[model samples]
Target: MPAPVPTPAPVPRQRDTSPAEGGPGTGSLYGQASLTLLVIEDDPAGGLTVPEILDVDGHRIRLRSARNLTEATRLLTPDVNCVLLDLALPHGATGSGSGSGSSDPVDPLAALRQVLRIAPRHAVLVLTSEEDAERAAEAVRVGAQDFLFRDELDGRLLSRAIRYAVERKRADIAQYKLAESKLRAQENARLERGLLPHPLLEGSDLRFAARYRPGRSRALLGGDFYDTVRTPDGTVHAMIGDVCGHGPDEAALGVELRIAWRALTLAGLCGDDLLATLQEVLEVERPNEEIFATLCTVDIAPDGRRAGLCLAGHPAPLISRPGRPARLLPYEDSGPALGLLPRARWPRRQVELGGSWSLMLYTDGLIEGRIGKGKERLGQDGMVEMINRHLDSGLSGEGLLEASVTEARRLNGGELTDDVAVVLLSRSEA
Candidate 1:
C-alpha cells in the first residue's frame, strides 16, 4: 500500500470550545476573569478530556487544541490565558519554522522549555505520565507553573491549577511595576532638591520667608523662581521671577537663571547692568525664541531703611506698614521682560522704606487666581484687599504668606492653576 499521507494539523481552533457560562463572582483568579486553556498534544484524539470545568462563577473554562508547538503558538492569542504542553509529543514533530530546531526527545522537559519561550508572558503547565514524574518536577523548575501526570489528571485538578497559575503570573507582574514606580519617584525627588533654591543670607538682620507652589500635578517645581542674598557690601539683594510656561523645560531654565543671578550678584553686579547680563543668559538658555521671563529685583540698603527697585515686565512689590493699608509699589517706568527687548533697560527706581515695613515681592501667580467661578480674576486690586484683611488679623511673616495663598486657593474654588512664588522681607523697628 502506498505510504499514508500525514493528516494536516487540525485547523487551529479559532472558536472557544466551551460555553460562556458564568454567574456573578465567577471570574476571580480562582476563576474571576474567564480562563481559556490551550492543549498541545501529539495524538489529535488523546484521551485527555475536561468535559466540564466551571470556574467559581458558573462560567465554563474555554479550550483550544493544537497537535504541536507550531499550532500552539499560532493559537496563543491574548484570550488564551494559560497553556498545557503534553510532554510525550516528539520534539521532531514541531511544524516547519517552529525555530529552536528540535529539542532532545530524551530530555523530557525540552517541550516545556519550547512552550515557555514562545509564550513568556502567558502561564504554562506540563503534562506527563506517572512514570515520568521526575521529569515533570524538573519542568516546573524550568518555568512551568505546575506539572500534571496523565494518570492523575482530572477535570477539577486541572481547572484549579490553571487558575492558580494565572493568578501567580499577575502577581509577579504587579510587583515589578510597583518597584519601577517607586524607583522613578525617588530619582525625581533627588533632582527636585538639587534644583530648589537655598537663601544665602548670613550676617544680615533682615528676616526672609518665601513660599513656592507649582501648578502642574505631581510636579515639585515650575517656572517660578526666587532667591535672596546679602552681598559683602551689606546690600541685601532679593529677586522674584516667572517664565512664561508651566513645564519642566521652563522650570529648568528658571533654575539656571536663578543660579546665574546668584553668582553675578555675589560678584558685585547690580542694577540695570546685572539685569542686562541675566537677559543674555536667558537668551542662550531658553528653549525657544518666544520664551521670556518677568522679573523684579530689590537691593535694600545696609541700614534697611531704603531700597532700589528694578522691574523687567514683572509685577510691583506690595509694601505694608504699621497703621497703613497694604499697597503695590509704583511701577511707572518698568522695562520689557527679558528676551523681549535685547537692549531692555530695567531702570533702578529709588523707594523709601522707613525703619519698620514689610515688602512682599511675588510672581503674577499671586494676583491671577480666579475670583469665584466667574470669568473675573482676583487681580492686583483684589489681592491687595485680601492682604489687608489678613494683615488686620495680625498675620505676618510665614503666617501671612500661608494665609494669603490659602485664601487665594479658596476664592478660586480650588487650587490656583499657575505657579506661585512669594517672598516676604521684613525689618523690625523695635
Candidate 2:
C-alpha cells in the first residue's frame, strides 16, 4: 500500500492580506490580480494532493493539472503565470523531448529541465520530498524559481512562494533588458569614437581644430567624414567629404571612405587618382546606385606658404589672413562629386598661402541651415560673411568653429537638420 498523502495545513477563515497586494517596490505583475498555476504531476492514483490556494486578495488561485510533460505543454498558455512541477514524477514513455529516450535512468532533473524549457517565461516551483533536499536545491540552481517540500505543503506557503517566484522572474527579465540596453549604448559610443578622425600632425607646426555634429537625434556620427594627416614628404593632407543621406548606413560608408582615404593618403595617393579610387570604393560600398559623395582636399607644402586644393562638387575652403577679410577659395572649376560620373577628373589647383593664415574646410550642412522662420538658407556667401563677423571679434581656431556652429543653430531657430563637419588648419610664422 502507498503511504497516505499529506494534506495541506488548514487556511485561516479570514482573508489573508499581505504585502504582496499593492506592495511597495513591486512591479505591475504584482497586486490583487489572480494568478493561474500549471501543475505537472503524474498522480493518476490520487496519491499526491494539492490544497486550494488563495492569493493575498482572498481569491482562489486558479490551478490546472497535467498528468505528464506532453499534457503540460498542451496546457502551457500565456495566461499561466506559474508552473509547479513534482520532481519525483516518472519520466514516462511520453517522448516530450526531455531526453527520456536516453539509457540513463539516474538523471533526476530531466523532468524539471523539460518543464523549464517549455515554460521559460513562467515562474517555476519544484516540489520534492524531504529526503531529496540535494535534488531540490539542484532544481532551483537549474533555473527553477523556487523549491517546495511535499510534506510541508500549505496553502499560505505555496501562495507566498508563487508570488515571490513570479516577482523574481519579472525582476530578472527587466534586469536583462536594462543590461542589454546599456551594453548597446556603450558599444555605440565606442564605435563612434573609433570612427572620428584623429589628425596626425606631430612634427608639423599647423594648429588643427575640428567640430562635427550629426543631424539625427541622439546620433554621434553622420554621413560627414574628414581626416588630416601629415605625410612622410612633409605635406599636410586634409580631406572632408559628405555622403548623400543621413542614416546609419551612410555613416558607416562615410567611415569606410574616411579610413580608405587615410590609408591611400598615407600610401602617397593624391589628387585625381585618389579621388577616382575613392569613387570606385563608394560605387561598391554604397547601399544604392543613386548615392554619391562630395569631397574637398588640400595638401599643404612643407614651407606652409603654398597649398594644393582639389574639390569634387564640394564647397571651396575659406581662407582668412591677418588683414584680409575671410573669403572662399576658387570653386568654379570643381569636378563632379565622387560616384556621380563614370570617369571624372578632379584637377588639383595650386594656391599661394601667406605666412600666417587659416584654411577652413567644411560640409554643406554648415551653410544650408535656414535663417530664422524663412525658407532662406545661409548659402556659401552668407557663411563667408558670418566668418568675417566672427573674425572681426578676434575669434580663431576652435572658438571660430564653435561660434560659427552656435550662430547657425540660432539662425535656424533650433538644431540644424543636417550633418555638419568643419576642419580648420592654421599656420603661424612665430
RMSD, each candidate, Å?
5.7, 5.7
Candidate 2 per-residue C-alpha lDDT over 1-430 given as tens digits, one digit per residue, 9 for 90 to 100? 1244655222212133332433222323454367777777666335335557877778777677777788877776656778888877765724464545211367778888777777777789988888889999998899998998877777899989888998888887788899999998999889778889889998999999999999999887999999999998899999999999999999989999999999999999999999999999999999999999999999999999999999999999999999999898977789999999999999999999989999999999999999989899999999999999999998999999999999999999999999999999999987
- TM-score for each candidate, following the candidate numbering: 0.80, 0.80
Q: Please provide, for model 1 over 1-430, each residue's C-alpha lDDT reduced to its tens digit, 9 standing for 90 to 100.
A: 1111243223134584333344211234544456777888876454364556666465777678888788887887766778888877777767754556345645666677778788887778887787788888888888888888766666789888887887776676678789998998999889877887788889888899989999999888999999999999899999999999999999989998999999999999998999999999999999999999999999999999999999999999999999999999999999999999978798999999998899999998889988877989999999999999999999999999999999999998998899999999999888
lDDT: worst 10-residue window of model 1 = 1-10
TM-score of 2: 0.80
What alpha-carbon RMSD in Å does predicted model 1 have with respect to the real structure?
A: 5.7
Candidate 1: where are CA atoms >4 Å away? 1-12, 16-33, 38-49, 64-76, 83-150
